[model samples]
Structure formats: C-alpha cells, structure tokens
Target: MKIAVIGTGNVGGALARKWARAGHRVTLGVRNTTEFKGKELLDEKNISVAEIEEAVKKSDVILIAAVPQATADIVKLMGNVSGKVIIDAMNSVRTKPDGFNNSFEALKALATSAEIVKCFNSVGFNVMADTNFNETIADMYTAGTSERAKEVAKQLSIDAGFENCYNFGGDDKVALLEQFALSWINLAMMQGQGREMIFKLIKR
Candidate 1:
C-alpha cells in the first residue's frame, strides 16, 4: 500500500521507519520536508519523505501524525481529501482545561472526502512499533465508519508489526480511545510510567 505520513516528528518518524522497513511504499509528509532535520532516518529506512500535499496526493492512506494544536490549520491546507483513507494518529488534548477536544471535528471540517479512522492512538510510539508483550498479549484498537478503511488500517497495523488489531467499534468510538489515553497518562503519573507504557486491550 502507498502510505503518506503527515509529520516528521517522533510519532511520524518512528512509524514511517517501521512501515518502510516492512516494505510498504512509504512517504513521510512534512510542511518543508526538505528542511527537516531527520533526513538520516528516511535514508536509513529507504523511504521517500516529501512535502505534505505531494505526499498526500500520491498515497492511498494519509496518516496525520502532526501536533494537536496545529491539526486544524494544517488539515485546512490539504483540501479536498474526499475518498481517501485518513488515519487520525493525533492527540487533541486541551492542557488548560486538562481534558480533550475532537480531532474528528477538525478532520470533518477540513476533510469532507476522506474516510477517517482512529488508530495508533492510545499507545506510545515504541509500543506501537513493537507490540511484543508477554503471554498476556495485547491488541491494537481501531475505529472507522468504512469497513474497507478499517480493514486497510488493520493490514497496516499488521505490516507495522501488530498481530492482533481489535475491530472495536465505529468512527465515533474515538472518544473512548481518547479517554483511555488520558486514563493511561493519569496512571503513568501514579506509577511513574511517564507515557512510556502501552495500553492494550487484552483478554481477562
């Protein structure tokens, strides 16, 4: 699959590397990708990193791994995204209020032509690229209205190294995942995990 990752930061960098290493046609998207400092990463992974619009225009799946605060405006720049599979990998937490906002709303406002799926969310970057838990095994959770989109994401998850991706619910189920991330943060504060641990939906 042709994958375009929108962001050159940690989340985007890590995922892009893994996807490229997994042998998918990966494109790392950034505002000014040529000026990005992480060129060595893409070079090592043999992946192509380019401008946001160019990457999106050439891919089947467009993954948003950019900053939460800038999501709306950035998405606005990538207009007419209809019929594309948009992967929402951003956290829209409002620090002042100590809560969350809706990434879907921002996507909805800007991406009328896209089928949005929320995944790779709720978990940290390391855990995302490496889902090898002990026998208590974990599952990647994904949500999307389009069955095809979610299935595509499930395959991407598998390619990214996850063996089990739970088809938990539909697109609107994103809130539950966002709240789960918040809960993970709270527990991390208590257990000294510092968002380093991952939350997997394992069987009881």
Candidate 2:
C-alpha cells in the first residue's frame, strides 16, 4: 500500500513510520519540506517525503492528519482523488466557546471523488504506534460508510501493530465527533497515566 500521510505532527509521524515499517511505500505530505529532514524513523522505515499534491497523487490511501480547518483546502488541492480511500485522522478542538461543526468539513472533503473514513482521531500517538497493555493491546475504532474503507482502516491498524481494531461504521456523523471529544477529554484528565492510556470498550 502506498500511503500519504499529511501533517508532520505526532500523529502523522507515527503513522508514517508504522506503515513504512510494514513494507508499504509511504510518502509524507508536509506543509514545509524542511521539517521532515531529521526524522530517524522516516528513512529507516523506507518512507519518502513529498509535497501535498505529489503525495496524494501517488498513494493508495491519503491519510489527512492536518489541522481540522486545513482539511478541505487539502482536499481541493488534491482535486479528483477519485477511487482512492481517504482516511481522515483530524481532531477539531476550538479554543473559542462556539465549537466548529467538525463533521461538516469532513463531509465537504468527501466531495472529492474519494471513499472517506473517519478514524485514528481517537487515540494518542503512542497507542497508535505500539499498543500493548497488561492484557491485550488497544483497539483502533473506525467509522466509514464504505466497507472497503473500513477494511482499509482495520488493515492499517493491524499493520501499525494494534492487536485489534473495530469498524464503528457510517459516514460523516456529527455523533462521531461528540464521541471523539468526550473520549479525548476523559483521556486528557487521566494525568500521570499520561497519553499512553487508550479507551477500549469491552462487553461481557
């Protein structure tokens, strides 16, 4: 799988390294090319770094790890990214009192000819990279309309070293954002435990 991971932040960096290690041809899409020069994990895992359009044009999956507000613009930049799967891993957290209607932008981005899946936005970079706990590793939850998109999400999760992943299903639901935020806040509150902890829903 040729994957393009935009945004050089923790999320993108982690995913880029993981997939590249998994033997996929991975390209990193960056706002600034110079920011990626010193990543030891990148080249070690056979990852190539490129500008936004180049990455999107040459990959099987385009993982949008940019700031939430920047998503649509990148989608426009990659105009007609049809027949490719788009995995959105952005988190929309506004400092302002009135929060953004986050799902609206994701829906708009899906306007591009692409299969969209909202995922990898729930957990921290540590968990995403190597999730191993006392019992079992964490599960990566994914929500997407297309079955193929969900399958890609699950495959990506497994390739990234997760023992389990759940396809939570559907497309562009506002409820997903609410669930993400609520989980994020709770995870944030667990200090000392730090960002390594993950939310794993289990049933008896």
lDDT of 1 by residue, 1-204 (tens): 888888767777777877888888888777776688457776755578777787888888988877766776667666657688998877766521112367765676567778888887767776665667664444677876778888888888887777677876886787787777677767776668775566665456
How much is the lDDT of residue 46 in candidate 2?
73
Backbone Cα, N, C clashes tallied per candidate: 2, 0
- Residue pairs clashing in model 1 are 82-113, 83-113
lDDT of each: 0.74, 0.73
Q: Report the poorest 10 consecutive residues by lDDT, candidate 2.
A: 95-104
Best by TM-score: 1
lDDT of 2: 0.73
